[model samples]
Target chain A: MLDAHLRLSSLAHLGLAARSIEEAGDAGIALGEVPRRVALTLRGDGEDAAFLDAVGRALGTAPPLTANTVASLEDVVILWLGPDEWLVNAPAAREDALQALRSALGDLHHAVADVTESRTVLRLSGASARDLLAQGCSLDFHPSVFQPGMCAGSHLALTHVTIHQIAEDPVYEIHVHRSFADYLWRWLEAASEPYGLAVVTG
Target chain B: MLLITCPWCGVREEHEFACGGEAHIVRPLDSHTLDDAEWADYVFMRRNPKGVQYERWVHNDGCRRWFNMARHTVSHEILAIYKVGEPKPEFEG
Candidate 1:
């Protein structure tokens, strides 16, 4: 386990060190097959109700999920990426799912992107997750402001990253690209040292 | 090297912006009428004019929006920049 920990570089080796955006099942936190076509979608232009309803049906859930909780619309999960933009991360294995959305919602004016190799999700848990984040970011990540079901995107360590507080257990998943993963991980670990951050590995 | 003043992140080097070929090449939504050659031309052809040229740039590392820039290809100087929806305001200073 220590060897695995040591493999994570500490020196800031900037330039494509992280993995691309990934999607997996909620049941398996920090473990799942990385989707091939991770859609970074833009849904601000059209009606979200029909699209959300369709996703809710596919995911075995109901529409109109209240804010402050993670919701699934189908294979694509509604992660509050920002105020107006929600990342619709559909797994590549579900090509039919993507096709269904495109075919049925042609009038929606949503932009779907295939960004599998461009981003990676790093699972940050242990007790020190929040402390590590506070050190590098300007956001007031108080428990009430940034807790479970809260997802925020901003600049971290000179790179663009979106940090999602996934669970009440304080398991926050950090997303960065393959190019920025190493630098971010190292920065995270170093920032977490004071609070004793244990690198969670599979 | 030319420097760009990002409306969001402030002034920085030109390395942050990725050249997006044309400044305003509107894509034809009705592709049924476009011939194969015409489509290819629109896709592949780039106007790398010498000076005072209007070009497209994407703030990949910053705001992540498409914007226009009036850049001199020869000297690598950006004369102006504007957002995608707004028109290029006349150069004031």
Candidate 2:
């Protein structure tokens, strides 16, 4: 039997030592990993009223229909991947939402897979967060083009990442697969080095 | 880089998509009945015109669905993109 206290982290190899630099300028950029978030890939027909109602009942909100947009109900944030597909991010400690989703969606022609263990959530926030990402990402990061609540899947540097704009200060949440976490972290650190990068871990 | 618009997802970067050769190439209904020349035409012959051409592309990184695209092979400009089973859009250019 696995020991309850023996916890393993996807980014454990990189270690949790926080690194920062003192500068006279604004908080240049802070990067950190979000721990213990339940991730699920939800697939269903968005046009079906029954399907939408069931999903809403499970997550306390309907799956967003807008392209590349996100719908949040408390701690759970549903990111629209496609017309009929969404990625649900919720608090990891709660299993009630997952159970509710399974029971409510059992009869529908839908799919719900727990992807919590497969993805690593990385948060980037600062005055230069947008500019830092703009260096590698091709998408237009201007406020007029990409605002809060919008999410997109695009290649950042050398790998694919899903970036979500969380706030006006340009706090961005990047979700990448566990295998690419280290590479992405190192790459991001180097990219933001000019702006004085800081690493924070929990 | 070309910006290919997915039928389901909106316009995304060219890297997210994978081009699947010529589009609208209907396979022979009965292959056994066809002669060698007809088989060769069906298998090898494709319209690789200089201007507007029809082709298939898949959004591999995003929605992961195959869709048809009408583009200019010379300029690499996407003229139109439509879903499967839908009629091809008229080529305006």
Among all windows of ten consecutive residues in candidate 2 chain A, which has the lowest summed lDDT? A18-27
Q: Could you give the C-alpha RMSD of every candidate to the true structure, in order shown? A: 11.0, 3.0
lDDT, candidate 2, A65-95, per-residue tens: 9888999977889998888889999986765
Tell me how candidate 1 scores on lDDT.
0.57
Query: Looking at candidate 1, what TM-score does chain B attain?
Result: 0.77
Interface RMSD of each: 7.5, 1.7
Q: Which regions of candidate 2 are displaced past 4 Å?
A: A1-7, A17-26, B27-44
- lDDT (tens digit, per residue) of candidate 1 on A9-96: 2222432224322432232223211223354543443246776565455444422233323456445555644223456556655555
How well does candidate 1 score on lDDT at residue A92?
A: 53
